[model samples]
Target: MSSNAALLFQGGIGVIGLVAMLLFGIPVLLVGPGLWPSILLGALGASLTYAALLLLTRVPGLFPENLERQMQGLYDFASSYSPVVLILLSLLAGVGEELLFRGAIQGWLMANTDPVTAVLAASVLFGLVHYVSFTYFLVATGLGLILGAAYVLSESLVLVMVWHALYDMIALYCLLRFPRWFGVRIVDPVTNRPHE
Candidate 1:
């Protein structure tokens, strides 16, 4: 895709995040009460997420065959972009998606229902939003649960944002750089390496 098109999509994601924050009153962002503590918690969350990613990709028969196709598509698409653009896209997704999913969806649910209910419902919605395949939906939902737990534990939207962004950045790098990890074998024409 063209850079301008990518930027436009990135901006749309950010706009959605802002809208969610506005609706749910999460404007404080990094200035929220537990900022310092959340930072450490975010790092911890990222570590846990990374472990999950590794397990999902590395374990045989853990993910269905379709997931290999899903990863192959992701690798092909991601490998087309410059690494910097990919990082920026992942960062936007982290911040924007967290704001919408954790800050708004889960936050509102917490107010209207129980905490566990809120997390599950929001996680389901998060999974639905990123639905590329059933396997992908499950993966996204599981990831959402992790992020939701981080948000609840720290009571900080920024924590999940940081955790998510770091995880995406690293995951994207790995997905593109090591397609074989996900049972893919295509070499990225742009990078002249990895699965194409």
Candidate 2:
């Protein structure tokens, strides 16, 4: 398939995932808008995540080689798409993942377990889903911790969703627009040469 077609297909999958999350389980009310803490905590969490990633990228050897390669591959793929498509995918991921992981899984666990246990449990599962490599898993797990804490402390699912989405957007932007700063060398998949 053409690159643009591939991106559109991926976007379709994201939309379907979101719709399934909404239709299959999550209550409409759970994702509903809330007050100040929601927006505040969301932006705070996303900004913190972006800052951490930027710093980590600058510090060579901070991330495992395999992890770096995996992340570079992801960024390369993302950069192939238009900004609008990337944003939609990011939004879908934010909504779908937050609804399932935080709203459904963590929320349910919190009822039966301690807050710490609930967060950890949910975070572990969250990490497992992104199991590309050990390093990627750990990074995702750490993100889950931050997102979970934000959700628990603020009691706002919407907030975490926004955090997750904005965090993704920032990451995508950096990876696509500033690969050199992050030490990423995007290569053509077929030719295995540096992408111009």
Candidate 3:
């Protein structure tokens, strides 16, 4: 498929995921108060995981690329927005996604099976929910595992929600405002090549 087509498809997937989450997540909030803390913890846990990943990359010969530079670019974009917008973005991403993936799917699975099996099933569904390119799918799967673990580890969705929001905000900010930092160059794929 053409690059434009591929981009459009990816965008579509993101929208679909958002919509699905909204459709199923709102009711859970009405049912009980306990779920809120789980959501909060899930978000926080995810954010911490990201920090750990960054630190891991700092070890010698660990991170080959300039990941820190990319992070700075993301920060730059995030800084551009007002505090309100940032908070809203974080809420929507953290709460919405966790509710759908962990709250709905994982919660259901755990009700009927072992925690390990439930997490595995939920993680796979989480990955599939964000269906994009193959590489994106792999990344999403890895992310799902992290999010799932947060839920199981703390039995809280709050951590994962925060983590998911921060993760997406950083990525969105980087992509929208600092494409170059991420090593993305919009050259013709047919003729693109590395410098020797």
Candidate 1 segments whose C-alpha is farther than 4 A from its true place: 23-33, 187-196
TM-score ranking from best candidate downward:
1, 2, 3
Tell me the TM-score of model 1. 0.85
Candidate 1 residue lDDT tens string, 64-104: 65677888788878877898888788788888788778877
Candidate 2 or 3, higher TM-score? 2
Q: Give all candidates' CA lDDT scores.
A: 0.79, 0.77, 0.61
Per-candidate clashes, comma-separated? 4, 0, 23
List pairs with backbone clashes in candidate 2.
Answer: none
Q: Residue 91 in model 1: shift from native, Å?
A: 1.0
Clashing pairs for predicted structure model 1, backbone only:
186-195, 186-196, 187-195, 187-196
lDDT of 3 by residue, 67-152 (tens): 54544444555555665666566557666667767777777667668778878887887778765444445556778888787677
Tens digits of per-residue lDDT for model 2 on 1-196?
4556655654564465456555655432243346566777677879888998777766767777555577677876787677888887788778777877887777767877888998999999999988888888888999999888878877778898889999988889877888876557877789989977
RMSD of each: 3.2, 4.1, 7.8
The total of clashing pairs for model 2 equals 0
